[model samples]
Target: MASSEESFLARRIDAEAFPLAVVDVLALAAVLTIGVINHNGVEYLSTNTVGWLLTLVPFLVGWAVAGPLVGAYSAGAAESAKAAVPLAVRAWIPGSIIGFALRASPLFSGGFQWTFGVVVLLTGGVSLAVFRWLFFKLRG
Candidate 1:
């Protein structure tokens, strides 16, 4: 009887691991997609190398924020979405700032200025929200 119970528990653990892995993969894909779209649409002041570096800034910052906010890597999928919101907001601020600064660089023909800033802020917020929503759904 004890052996049977242990086997059942192990199966449950394995089931849970699969979903968590899926969530992480989805989150990573979403972030990467956002970066690619933003880079393709926006013109930057730096050379290709600099532009690539700048492109990663927002995604990295957002990921850092989301990881702690949603407890993605540390707390696991069982954490509540409410606990993640503040961290998401904190992450958005810096990501927006960095994105805006990059857009203003003279490497591009015309600086997007306000438009780019708004887009970055919106993108960060939306991305975080979507990620959190998906996380909660999967966890529940």
Candidate 2:
């Protein structure tokens, strides 16, 4: 039990994972803005930080969980560190699956479809690519 706790704590403090999580959260925020639009044609998009954060909860949860589970944030993987883009792409698979599942809950009004899954996959991969690249570069 102590070993498990320690492992959990170590993962929680991981520097690379921390930034990746932030990137995931921010990416979903952007996705919500770009993927959904007011058909009414507002001159500008309004900011609702509270509402936006609420909507992002599922994505954030998925991303944070996926990194540790998939070894995306594992220490000392030199080859993966050298190829962050592929790592990002691979990590996004399970990450987005969890995101899709959570976001599909009835709590969210946005209906999930095949295309939404694809959008989530693409956006998440792109998002992780940029952030993880930065992480690898900085870590080096």
Best by TM-score: 2
Q: TM-score of model 1 relative to the true fold? A: 0.48
CA lDDT of 18 in candidate 1? 43
lDDT of each: 0.52, 0.62
Tens digit of lDDT per residue, candidate 2, span 15-100? 64555556555665676555545431223345554455555666667767775666565543233446446655676788778878
lDDT of 1 at 108: 36
* Residues 1-140, model 1: lDDT tens digits: 46986754443333333444355335544564556556664343333545555555544654544443333333333355664444455555765564455545664333556765666567666666677676777667
What is the alpha-carbon lDDT for the whole of candidate 2?
0.62
Q: List runs of model 2 lying over 4 Å from the truth.
A: 1-13, 37-51, 77-83, 134-140
